[model samples]
Target: MRQVLLINKDPDMHSDLNSLFQENNYESVILDEVETGNEALRKVVNDSYDMLILNLDLPNTNMLGLINKLRLLNQDLPILIYSLELEYIFIKRYLTSGVNGYCFFKNGDVGEILDAAVRISTGKWYISQEMVELIVEKALYSKKIDRFDNLDEQEFEILTHLIKGDTVANIAKIMGVHLPTVSVYKTRILDKLRITSLLELKNIIKIPLLSES
Candidate 1:
């Protein structure tokens, strides 16, 4: 059985996660808080766990620094970050930080959390594809150039917006295209990528961009 450790400060979040993991037959160890980065590091060094679910905005300890320290200790252990902060730049930086996986607390679901855990337990990694689309699209817009050489201009735009957590209706308005058109673009993007879900998309983007943005 996979032994999973959840390091988060919120009670409701921990309860929800405990219920999910218990149903799935995984042993869930809950740490209500890490008083300091050193405390967290000690746990990591002492325990043998398959996955560590962390809140990036931990109190006092620099989040990225802690993650870096954890990486140094257990280079391949899974770190699943779920934060309430929803900034593209922050997420982008963390993705490039060599952590195992990530999800936003707002947009993330119980299924996503479980999915990431299961994947990581198998020595695999996860990233949200929408994240990839978001980063690449941001690059395209800011740089005023094509960041996705793999995609055509319109396809690139659609995929980028899609990954930004945009709904089809919103994407339609932004692209000046109909809802159906946006859906069609989504289908084509998925087909080209050979992926079926946004979860799969996350795994794809999270892994390749581990070292560099």
Candidate 2:
């Protein structure tokens, strides 16, 4: 039997995952759940868990710092990032931090998660083929390029528009969408970077260079 500790806030999710794990014939893997980072710390420290599943959205948690601390605590423990964000750059950040594998949150994807956990526990790497290729490709580049890589097409467009001093209403008009849709995209962009305001990005981001006759 393998002990896999999952650190996430939602107990409902834990129940659903456990049920799925059992239904999918992963009975040998025990899914222990904890809510906070500290609780996860204590659980892993005291017990000999085979693997650790960390949620990126754990409330009030500095994820990278926690990963570093956990890595220092046990160099051999196979840690997996459990995240909902589909952004490759966001996943790469955590994967590079200290995690051995990742399980992106998708409805009814418990089998994939279990597979990743099982593989990593046995000292084998687990990730998508695209991610494997991407890792190799990205290794040659400076990490600064990945800062805004999480943005999708629309979000990037909105970001460029904002850089041009375009208001949300103006962007809505330009994009032929509702003001609320543009507003939501703006919020998602900020949330992705964990910034409350776009002003914070000015130092890190180059001014959008555009020239028109």
Would you list the C-alpha lDDT of every candidate in the order shown?
0.66, 0.71
lDDT string for model 2 (140-180, tens) is: 64344454656765676576566556788887876668999
- How accurate locally is residue 17 in candidate 2, as Cα lDDT from 0 to 100? 70
| Sliding window of 10 residues with minimal summed lDDT for model 1 | 204-213
| TM-score, model 2 to reference | 0.63
**Candidate 1: regions farther than 4 A off:** 27-36, 139-213
Worst 10 contiguous positions by lDDT, candidate 2: 204-213
Clashing pairs in 2: none
